[model samples]
Target: MAHQTPDLIVSRRYLRLDCLCLLLLMLSACSSSDQIEQQSRTVASASQTVLMALDAWAAGAAPTAYTVDTLQSIGKTLADTGAQIRSAETSEPTEQASLTKAVNDLSVAVTRAEAGLQADDRLKVQDAQQDLRLASRALATAYAKYFAPKP
Candidate 1:
Protein backbone atom coordinates (compact mmCIF):
# COMPACT_ATOMS: atom_id res chain seq x y z
CA MET A 1 0.00 0.00 0.00
CA ALA A 2 1.12 3.54 -0.65
CA HIS A 3 2.04 5.69 2.30
CA GLN A 4 -0.42 8.31 3.47
CA THR A 5 2.09 10.96 4.20
CA PRO A 6 1.19 14.18 5.97
CA ASP A 7 1.47 16.11 2.70
CA LEU A 8 -0.98 13.77 1.04
CA ILE A 9 -3.44 14.07 3.92
CA VAL A 10 -3.18 17.84 3.92
CA SER A 11 -3.62 18.06 0.15
CA ARG A 12 -6.67 15.83 0.30
CA ARG A 13 -8.29 17.87 3.05
CA TYR A 14 -7.63 21.17 1.29
CA LEU A 15 -8.97 19.93 -2.02
CA ARG A 16 -12.18 18.69 -0.38
CA LEU A 17 -12.64 21.89 1.58
CA ASP A 18 -12.25 23.86 -1.63
CA CYS A 19 -14.79 21.63 -3.29
CA LEU A 20 -17.49 22.53 -0.76
CA CYS A 21 -17.02 26.20 -1.57
CA LEU A 22 -17.48 25.79 -5.33
CA LEU A 23 -20.08 28.06 -6.95
CA LEU A 24 -21.30 28.93 -10.45
CA LEU A 25 -21.28 32.46 -11.86
CA MET A 26 -23.36 34.12 -14.55
CA LEU A 27 -26.90 33.78 -15.90
CA SER A 28 -29.43 36.27 -17.22
CA ALA A 29 -33.03 35.31 -17.79
CA CYS A 30 -33.18 37.48 -20.89
CA SER A 31 -30.22 38.39 -23.07
CA SER A 32 -27.89 35.69 -21.80
CA SER A 33 -30.32 32.86 -22.41
CA ASP A 34 -28.22 31.50 -25.23
CA GLN A 35 -25.09 31.50 -23.11
CA ILE A 36 -26.71 29.55 -20.30
CA GLU A 37 -28.00 27.04 -22.79
CA GLN A 38 -24.55 26.59 -24.23
CA GLN A 39 -22.94 26.22 -20.81
CA SER A 40 -25.37 23.51 -19.77
CA ARG A 41 -24.78 21.59 -22.96
CA THR A 42 -21.05 21.89 -22.53
CA VAL A 43 -21.32 20.54 -19.01
CA ALA A 44 -23.31 17.57 -20.20
CA SER A 45 -20.90 16.76 -23.01
CA ALA A 46 -17.79 17.16 -20.88
CA SER A 47 -19.35 15.02 -18.17
CA GLN A 48 -19.66 12.06 -20.48
CA THR A 49 -16.04 12.35 -21.47
CA VAL A 50 -14.88 12.39 -17.90
CA LEU A 51 -17.05 9.45 -16.93
CA MET A 52 -15.83 7.41 -19.86
CA ALA A 53 -12.22 8.23 -19.06
CA LEU A 54 -12.71 7.14 -15.49
CA ASP A 55 -14.34 3.93 -16.57
CA ALA A 56 -11.45 3.19 -18.90
CA TRP A 57 -9.01 3.62 -16.06
CA ALA A 58 -11.05 1.46 -13.71
CA ALA A 59 -11.28 -1.31 -16.28
CA GLY A 60 -7.49 -1.34 -16.79
CA ALA A 61 -7.87 -0.13 -20.34
CA ALA A 62 -5.90 3.02 -19.49
CA PRO A 63 -2.92 3.80 -17.34
CA THR A 64 -3.03 5.88 -14.17
CA ALA A 65 -1.12 8.86 -15.57
CA TYR A 66 -3.26 8.94 -18.69
CA THR A 67 -6.43 8.76 -16.66
CA VAL A 68 -5.23 11.49 -14.36
CA ASP A 69 -4.41 13.70 -17.33
CA THR A 70 -7.82 13.08 -18.85
CA LEU A 71 -9.54 13.85 -15.58
CA GLN A 72 -7.58 17.06 -15.20
CA SER A 73 -8.38 18.03 -18.76
CA ILE A 74 -12.09 17.52 -18.17
CA GLY A 75 -11.87 19.17 -14.80
CA LYS A 76 -10.75 22.35 -16.60
CA THR A 77 -13.91 22.19 -18.64
CA LEU A 78 -15.97 22.16 -15.46
CA ALA A 79 -13.97 25.04 -14.11
CA ASP A 80 -14.51 27.06 -17.27
CA THR A 81 -18.20 26.36 -17.25
CA GLY A 82 -18.40 27.42 -13.62
CA ALA A 83 -16.59 30.64 -14.41
CA GLN A 84 -18.93 31.42 -17.26
CA ILE A 85 -21.88 30.73 -15.01
CA ARG A 86 -20.47 33.11 -12.44
CA SER A 87 -19.80 35.92 -14.87
CA ALA A 88 -23.11 35.99 -16.75
CA GLU A 89 -26.04 38.17 -15.76
CA THR A 90 -29.15 36.47 -14.39
CA SER A 91 -32.76 37.42 -14.85
CA GLU A 92 -33.56 34.42 -12.72
CA PRO A 93 -31.60 34.72 -9.52
CA THR A 94 -33.30 31.71 -8.00
CA GLU A 95 -32.49 29.56 -10.98
CA GLN A 96 -28.95 30.80 -10.98
CA ALA A 97 -28.61 29.85 -7.34
CA SER A 98 -29.88 26.36 -8.05
CA LEU A 99 -27.50 25.99 -10.96
CA THR A 100 -24.67 27.12 -8.79
CA LYS A 101 -25.34 24.28 -6.39
CA ALA A 102 -25.55 21.74 -9.19
CA VAL A 103 -22.36 22.97 -10.77
CA ASN A 104 -20.57 22.93 -7.47
CA ASP A 105 -21.67 19.39 -6.86
CA LEU A 106 -20.18 18.38 -10.19
CA SER A 107 -16.99 20.23 -9.44
CA VAL A 108 -16.66 18.41 -6.16
CA ALA A 109 -17.29 15.08 -7.81
CA VAL A 110 -14.49 15.70 -10.28
CA THR A 111 -12.07 16.60 -7.55
CA ARG A 112 -13.01 13.52 -5.58
CA ALA A 113 -12.36 11.33 -8.60
CA GLU A 114 -8.90 12.79 -9.04
CA ALA A 115 -8.24 12.46 -5.33
CA GLY A 116 -9.22 8.82 -5.39
CA LEU A 117 -6.70 8.18 -8.15
CA GLN A 118 -3.98 10.07 -6.32
CA ALA A 119 -4.60 7.98 -3.25
CA ASP A 120 -4.57 4.76 -5.28
CA ASP A 121 -7.90 3.82 -3.73
CA ARG A 122 -10.14 1.90 -6.10
CA LEU A 123 -12.99 1.98 -3.62
CA LYS A 124 -12.76 5.71 -3.38
CA VAL A 125 -12.55 5.97 -7.14
CA GLN A 126 -15.71 3.88 -7.51
CA ASP A 127 -17.44 6.07 -5.00
CA ALA A 128 -16.34 9.11 -6.95
CA GLN A 129 -17.74 7.61 -10.13
CA GLN A 130 -21.11 7.21 -8.44
CA ASP A 131 -20.87 10.76 -7.22
CA LEU A 132 -20.18 11.96 -10.76
CA ARG A 133 -23.16 10.04 -12.14
CA LEU A 134 -25.54 11.43 -9.54
CA ALA A 135 -24.17 14.94 -9.84
CA SER A 136 -24.47 14.90 -13.60
CA ARG A 137 -28.07 13.77 -13.36
CA ALA A 138 -28.83 16.46 -10.84
CA LEU A 139 -27.37 19.13 -13.08
CA ALA A 140 -29.41 17.99 -16.05
CA THR A 141 -32.65 17.49 -14.17
CA ALA A 142 -32.42 20.82 -12.43
CA TYR A 143 -31.69 22.83 -15.56
CA ALA A 144 -32.62 20.85 -18.64
CA LYS A 145 -35.59 23.08 -19.34
CA TYR A 146 -33.24 25.95 -20.03
CA PHE A 147 -31.26 24.26 -22.77
CA ALA A 148 -32.06 24.65 -26.45
CA PRO A 149 -33.14 21.52 -28.30
CA LYS A 150 -30.68 19.89 -30.66
CA PRO A 151 -31.41 19.68 -34.37
Candidate 2:
Protein backbone atom coordinates (compact mmCIF):
# COMPACT_ATOMS: atom_id res chain seq x y z
CA MET A 1 0.00 0.00 0.00
CA ALA A 2 1.24 3.49 -0.79
CA HIS A 3 1.88 5.85 2.15
CA GLN A 4 -0.25 8.99 2.42
CA THR A 5 1.40 12.42 1.94
CA PRO A 6 1.27 15.32 4.43
CA ASP A 7 -1.37 17.12 2.29
CA LEU A 8 -3.59 14.02 2.31
CA ILE A 9 -3.31 13.66 6.07
CA VAL A 10 -4.22 17.35 6.56
CA SER A 11 -7.21 16.97 4.25
CA ARG A 12 -8.41 13.93 6.19
CA ARG A 13 -8.15 15.85 9.46
CA TYR A 14 -10.21 18.72 8.02
CA LEU A 15 -12.91 16.29 6.88
CA ARG A 16 -13.10 14.72 10.34
CA LEU A 17 -13.32 18.13 11.98
CA ASP A 18 -16.18 19.18 9.67
CA CYS A 19 -18.12 15.99 10.49
CA LEU A 20 -17.66 16.53 14.22
CA CYS A 21 -18.87 20.11 13.99
CA LEU A 22 -21.94 19.08 12.06
CA LEU A 23 -22.79 16.41 14.64
CA LEU A 24 -22.42 18.89 17.47
CA LEU A 25 -24.72 21.40 15.74
CA MET A 26 -27.40 18.78 15.23
CA LEU A 27 -27.15 17.73 18.87
CA SER A 28 -27.46 21.33 20.02
CA ALA A 29 -30.64 21.85 18.01
CA CYS A 30 -32.19 18.67 19.34
CA SER A 31 -31.30 19.64 22.91
CA SER A 32 -32.86 23.08 22.57
CA SER A 33 -36.16 21.76 21.23
CA ASP A 34 -36.27 18.95 23.78
CA GLN A 35 -35.65 21.37 26.63
CA ILE A 36 -38.48 23.62 25.43
CA GLU A 37 -40.89 20.70 25.23
CA GLN A 38 -39.98 19.44 28.68
CA GLN A 39 -40.28 22.86 30.33
CA SER A 40 -43.67 23.51 28.75
CA ARG A 41 -45.06 20.21 30.01
CA THR A 42 -43.71 20.83 33.47
CA VAL A 43 -45.35 24.27 33.66
CA ALA A 44 -48.67 22.87 32.41
CA SER A 45 -48.62 20.16 35.06
CA ALA A 46 -47.79 22.67 37.78
CA SER A 47 -50.58 24.99 36.66
CA GLN A 48 -53.12 22.21 36.72
CA THR A 49 -52.00 21.11 40.16
CA VAL A 50 -52.29 24.58 41.59
CA LEU A 51 -55.66 25.20 39.94
CA MET A 52 -57.05 22.00 41.41
CA ALA A 53 -55.75 22.96 44.82
CA LEU A 54 -57.44 26.33 44.50
CA ASP A 55 -60.74 24.69 43.66
CA ALA A 56 -60.51 22.38 46.62
CA TRP A 57 -59.69 25.26 48.89
CA ALA A 58 -62.64 27.24 47.57
CA ALA A 59 -64.97 24.32 48.31
CA GLY A 60 -63.56 23.96 51.85
CA ALA A 61 -62.35 20.43 51.04
CA ALA A 62 -58.74 21.49 51.52
CA PRO A 63 -57.39 23.06 54.69
CA THR A 64 -55.69 26.45 54.45
CA ALA A 65 -52.34 24.99 55.55
CA TYR A 66 -52.43 22.25 52.92
CA THR A 67 -53.52 24.69 50.24
CA VAL A 68 -50.69 26.99 51.16
CA ASP A 69 -48.24 24.11 50.92
CA THR A 70 -49.56 23.17 47.52
CA LEU A 71 -49.22 26.73 46.27
CA GLN A 72 -45.64 26.90 47.57
CA SER A 73 -44.75 23.63 45.87
CA ILE A 74 -46.25 24.77 42.58
CA GLY A 75 -44.51 28.11 42.93
CA LYS A 76 -41.16 26.36 43.26
CA THR A 77 -41.92 24.32 40.17
CA LEU A 78 -42.86 27.47 38.25
CA ALA A 79 -39.63 29.14 39.34
CA ASP A 80 -37.64 26.25 37.99
CA THR A 81 -39.65 26.31 34.81
CA GLY A 82 -39.02 30.01 34.42
CA ALA A 83 -35.30 29.45 34.73
CA GLN A 84 -35.44 26.75 32.10
CA ILE A 85 -37.40 29.03 29.78
CA ARG A 86 -34.83 31.79 30.11
CA SER A 87 -31.87 29.52 29.52
CA ALA A 88 -33.21 27.29 26.78
CA GLU A 89 -31.29 27.60 23.51
CA THR A 90 -34.12 27.68 21.05
CA SER A 91 -33.59 27.66 17.30
CA GLU A 92 -36.23 30.35 17.03
CA PRO A 93 -35.62 33.55 18.93
CA THR A 94 -39.29 34.56 18.77
CA GLU A 95 -40.34 31.31 20.36
CA GLN A 96 -37.82 31.86 23.15
CA ALA A 97 -39.07 35.37 23.78
CA SER A 98 -42.71 34.29 23.90
CA LEU A 99 -41.93 31.44 26.30
CA THR A 100 -40.13 33.81 28.65
CA LYS A 101 -43.14 36.09 28.81
CA ALA A 102 -45.52 33.20 29.39
CA VAL A 103 -43.49 31.83 32.26
CA ASN A 104 -43.17 35.24 33.86
CA ASP A 105 -46.91 35.74 33.67
CA LEU A 106 -47.56 32.37 35.23
CA SER A 107 -45.07 33.06 38.03
CA VAL A 108 -46.85 36.28 38.87
CA ALA A 109 -50.15 34.47 39.03
CA VAL A 110 -48.67 31.93 41.42
CA THR A 111 -47.40 34.66 43.71
CA ARG A 112 -50.84 36.22 43.80
CA ALA A 113 -52.39 32.87 44.61
CA GLU A 114 -49.97 32.35 47.49
CA ALA A 115 -50.70 35.79 48.84
CA GLY A 116 -54.46 35.31 48.57
CA LEU A 117 -54.26 31.99 50.36
CA GLN A 118 -52.24 33.49 53.20
CA ALA A 119 -54.76 36.34 53.56
CA ASP A 120 -57.71 33.98 53.41
CA ASP A 121 -59.25 35.87 50.51
CA ARG A 122 -61.25 33.45 48.39
CA LEU A 123 -62.02 36.06 45.73
CA LYS A 124 -58.37 36.81 45.16
CA VAL A 125 -57.60 33.13 45.01
CA GLN A 126 -60.35 32.60 42.42
CA ASP A 127 -59.02 35.46 40.32
CA ALA A 128 -55.55 33.99 40.57
CA GLN A 129 -56.86 30.69 39.21
CA GLN A 130 -58.19 32.51 36.15
CA ASP A 131 -54.91 34.31 35.66
CA LEU A 132 -52.97 31.08 35.95
CA ARG A 133 -55.25 29.33 33.48
CA LEU A 134 -54.72 32.06 30.95
CA ALA A 135 -50.99 32.00 31.48
CA SER A 136 -50.95 28.26 31.00
CA ARG A 137 -52.86 28.67 27.74
CA ALA A 138 -50.33 31.21 26.57
CA LEU A 139 -47.50 28.78 27.24
CA ALA A 140 -49.26 26.02 25.33
CA THR A 141 -49.85 28.36 22.41
CA ALA A 142 -46.21 29.30 22.22
CA TYR A 143 -45.09 25.70 22.46
CA ALA A 144 -47.49 24.69 19.72
CA LYS A 145 -46.37 27.50 17.48
CA TYR A 146 -42.78 26.42 17.85
CA PHE A 147 -43.43 22.76 17.07
CA ALA A 148 -46.35 22.92 14.69
CA PRO A 149 -45.98 20.78 11.58
CA LYS A 150 -45.47 22.46 8.23
CA PRO A 151 -48.23 22.17 5.67
Q: Which candidate is the best by lDDT?
A: 2
Give candidate 2's error at residue 124 in angstroms: 1.1
For model 1, residues 8-78, the per-residue Cα lDDT tens digits are 99999988877655422222244477777788789888888889989999899999999898889988989
lDDT on C-alpha atoms for all candidate structures: 0.80, 0.88
Superpose all Cα atoms of candidate 1 onto the true structure and report the RMSD in Å to 1 decimal: 21.3
Alpha-carbon runs more than 4 Å astray in model 2: 1-5
Q: Candidate 2: which pairs clash?
A: none
User: Number of the top candidate by TM-score?
Assistant: 2
Cα distance off (Å), candidate 1, residue 39: 0.7
Model 1 residue 151 lDDT? 52
TM-score of each: 0.74, 0.91
How many steric clashes does model 1 contain? 12
